[model samples]
Target chain A: MTRAEAFSEREVAMCTVARMVENGRTYWAAGGGTPLYSILLGKKLYAPEAQYVTEDGVIAPEPMLPYEPMMTMLAARASYRALAWGTMNTAGIYSQLGYMDYGVLNTLQVDRHGNINSTFLGEWGAGGRRMHGPGGADTIAACCWRTILITDQSKRKFIEKVDFISSPGYLDGSEGARERAGLPRNTGPWRVVTPWAMYDYQDRRLRLMARVPWVTVDEILAECEYKPLLAPEIQVLEPPTEEEVQLLRTELDVRGQTTDAAGGWIVWDGEKYIRGGGD
Target chain B: MTTVSEPATIEVLASGTAPYHKIDPDGFREWVRDNKQRALVPKLMTEKEAVQKFVADGDYITYECNYLTRGPNSLLHEIMRQQKKNLWIAGKFTYVDVGMLVGAGCAGKVDTGFFLCTPSVRQALDAGKLEVYEYSNVIMTMRLEAGAQGIPFIPVRSFGGTDGFNHSGAKLITDPYTGQPTVIIPALNPDVAIIHVQQADKFGNARIFGTGISDVPAALASRKVIVSAEEIIDTEEIRSNPGLTKIPYWCVDAVVEAPFAGYPGTVPGYYASDPAVVMEVFASVLRGAVEPYLEKWVFGVNSHQEMLEKNVGVAKLLDMRKRETIRGGLRA
Candidate 1:
């Protein structure tokens, strides 16, 4: 596939997440990679009225640029009064805050039960192959009204069981497990958006709900480590509209930071999408 | 668009066991119980002496700073320079500090919420040279809080849906009061906790601006606390503005006055993260040239003062200072 075709996966993922974002609901975007882009796109296009609670606990209604350097500078420029920690304790926000309505996150591995793991791969502590640990993902998964997980589809990632549970989804595929485990009843994994397909938990098990245009059910099943429960009425995911693509290229990521590979640049010129240009 | 028959039964993955399971909680409880009776006077020391005196081989140490600000970079470099081996480092949202320690082969085990994947650290993990345990940021913070509060454990709502519940050392318990299942993380008491602050007195009363992150809890949870400060003020000044003091002197073991201590990272009110240097280090690490980078920037220089002068240079430092001033002394 060409870079442009490969870029569409990102576009699809971001647009799918953008569509889920509701206006006036406070949403938390945690990771710096794809989820950051999704949240940025959501703010720019669909959820302009949505409030954002930054990792450091600053609440801003205005869209804060997701770039790290820019975010740091913006936080500083806004001052303490504008970007106060407020009543938000780091743990408290994750556990008790009712205002944190939605969270968009990325994880390394997922299972049929929507269990996500970004921690270790082998044994715990001594013999494990360490991956990046759960940052705020555990809290967000356990506490957010709804959580959307985004990842690239691969057999190793789409497994029967995660090596470790970095964040809880549905435990044991049983009803009331989340509530029984002391998670808020209304809070749990809501969607899983991958490069090939989208999944939703039904009957507390991950069910394939949609597939991207070019992907086939056989191909997706072949790529998954376990047999995924297919939805009765699975549908093809609608590709991003021309205007959505245009906004994504021209407004959300004008510099082509997200879409471009290292040393390769793709930008939307006034009339057409172009590659590698000074204009 | 396809439909498939539901599998007759789903197999649940059994939760993995943790290494800490062997550690007797009663022993830790006894240690905490004994420590509460003892009083400590804050000592004044240089960064070198503090690390040398406090940090030991196989010690579980922690430096509580997020990726953004107030990392004890100078102290961590000192630990690297000292070549303290078999050390277990704990952190929440660690970036360069943990990365460098793992890169330098100084860390034996890492207990952290989030760690950046620097090439050397990744290689180490791949090679099974380092042990790692994971927790969510809030879980780790609450664990430290449990230690600070002299409690054996604290119940939390996290890990319910996470694979972390299986692998983490945390226990699943039925809340006695409510009968709801809750995760209980054991108290995490580090051998030493090193933290950077905007200002600290000789008495070790430290003042941290901005978020404060997990520094206070980390300090209180540790057996010994080292305060690395941008400016060492008088005790009178700390007393005058008591609210600014995040970690009290009673919790602090030593105070080390080290300006530009969190270089490459940032100390709020002092400077912003040096992205150019960070990129340079990152590039070197990626290219498998970290040894030369460290040799020149860390070991080649006698001290942080010399390292700053030779590597960061006068111009960049002055520029950073000016930028901090323009930003109203807030880190960007």
Candidate 2:
């Protein structure tokens, strides 16, 4: 549990997300990659009582060890000892029934209002690069009580406004806008986990609440295209505990696809951690 | 820090101008009643025969579940191999299946919720060779349910604030009970529904081991169901566990015993997905060698069995089966 351990950006992001999973709460970490690692690691280390579900309707799936990296959310090889096996109907109906407490989503681009887009880059019809349409993020964002967004932090990603609202956030950043748009009241974006920091919605606007140990407030702000509202006291997150790092490396991400030191979003550049890696 | 602009309207206009692929519920119901077979006869056939007989040109078709799970890859390959023209596809949470279909020029229009926009699909879209309609996964699944129930539309609570709502056939309707705005998706009765299952009786009493992701509803909603299974079990075996039968014989029109039907995909207790094979196919697609890849795998082979023997050897398939043995003991 020592803090004097070198951690990659993925470890920081995964741990931050893991810490948010409350015990006994039900969560659906929508996509694979880091979001998958976060919930699985969270269940193992932090919230053992927390129930994790897949979009394919497997509830509380005890994922197999030595994780399979290639497979996404419907990873049969990774899932075993599932409490209940349902279908896409179960996933959607449960969420509508308010059973899904937390929904972690992966986004390609996010805005200051927490509106995220994983659909397209530019204007959707005018020759925008189509980055696969939303699978369940729209449903999760629209139905789940609380939503946590995860993505890498960069000027290109953290935009002033998303090209398309693939999922609902604080629509138009106005109070009661989500209700007006027919989304359930009190169910919207809750927190955002990124490589450099974590954010929460303040008055329906993205407000930076915490930063990783290595990064400064200026550095995070510099990386964002939009100026997000800063928390009154932006706490610096402690470096991941040695055990947390070990669990991620040896158990969840056995292939080093995500939590690897030399691969993924941030890397050790001899003297300091820097961005730009991963295949 | 730059000053933020004034908050914009919550309304999002659809970017694409493609017309929605709408089907008249009454017309579809009458057609299903007039065309579908109600006899309790064995509708056994090969993939080629099933696709040719049931799937026609310009028909709206969808498959059960998705490509990663119990995807009907053999049927899709057969559709491509036959070059079914002007076909419309309904893709819900699909990946390479839609891409391959579009790339092969079999399908021209897609009603999709989550389609992987491959370079080939993108090229087609840019070239005006393809049309895509957007919806959420839940809405699409619910549409199938609506279709199965012979309903015109079903009201839902989501997809209002997003851009997908603007592009889809779904409409924001006033809830009669609460007077609140609600999203209602139309019924989707596909012309043909191709499904792959672990086991099925000769009369198309199918049993899927894993999650039945919209298969039953899709089968019931479609005019025809082409079922491919790992094993053709006896009716007595199906009668032993009547509860496990997801798609009943009445909805199914053809039964094709095709093992490894969901190749490069998993079939729960049968075999684990072959990621290397999927990666290789995707890589070939990215390199613009879709034609060569298809020719080597789908078009070149005589049947799914021959394709398996030629492309994936028995040793590799057995290894996948061994990897999937973990689920055998766990399933009840």
- Highest DockQ among the candidates is held by which one? 2
Cα displacement (Å) at residue B140, model 2: 1.5
Candidate 2 lDDT over A184-278, as tens digits, reads 78899999888788999888999999997567899889989989998899998765777888888888877777766322454455666555554
Fraction of native Cα-Cα interface contacts (under 8 Å, chains A and B) also present in model 1: 0.51
- Which tens-of-lDDT digit does each residue in B1-332 have in candidate 2? 87655434323222323355565788877876887667779888999999989899998898876666668989989989889998888878776778888879887898777777877888899999888887877778888888889888777667777877777787765555555556777788888899998889999998877655688888988988899999999999888879888888988999999999988777777888887877777776766567777888899998888999989999999988888866643343
Screening candidate 2 with a backbone cut-off below 3 angstroms (N, C-alpha, C), the clashing residue pairs are none
Segments in model 2 whose C-alpha atoms lie over 4 Å from true places: A67-69, A72-75, A259-279, B1-18, B328-332
Q: Mark the 10 consecutive residues where model 1 chain A has the least summed lDDT.
A: A70-79
Which candidate wins on lDDT?
2
Native-vs-model 1 lDDT? Answer: 0.70
Q: Model-by-model lDDT, in order?
A: 0.70, 0.80
Is model 1 an incorrect, acceptable, medium or high docking prediction?
acceptable
Model 1 error, position A49 (Å): 3.1
Where does model 2 sit among the CAPRI classes?
A: medium
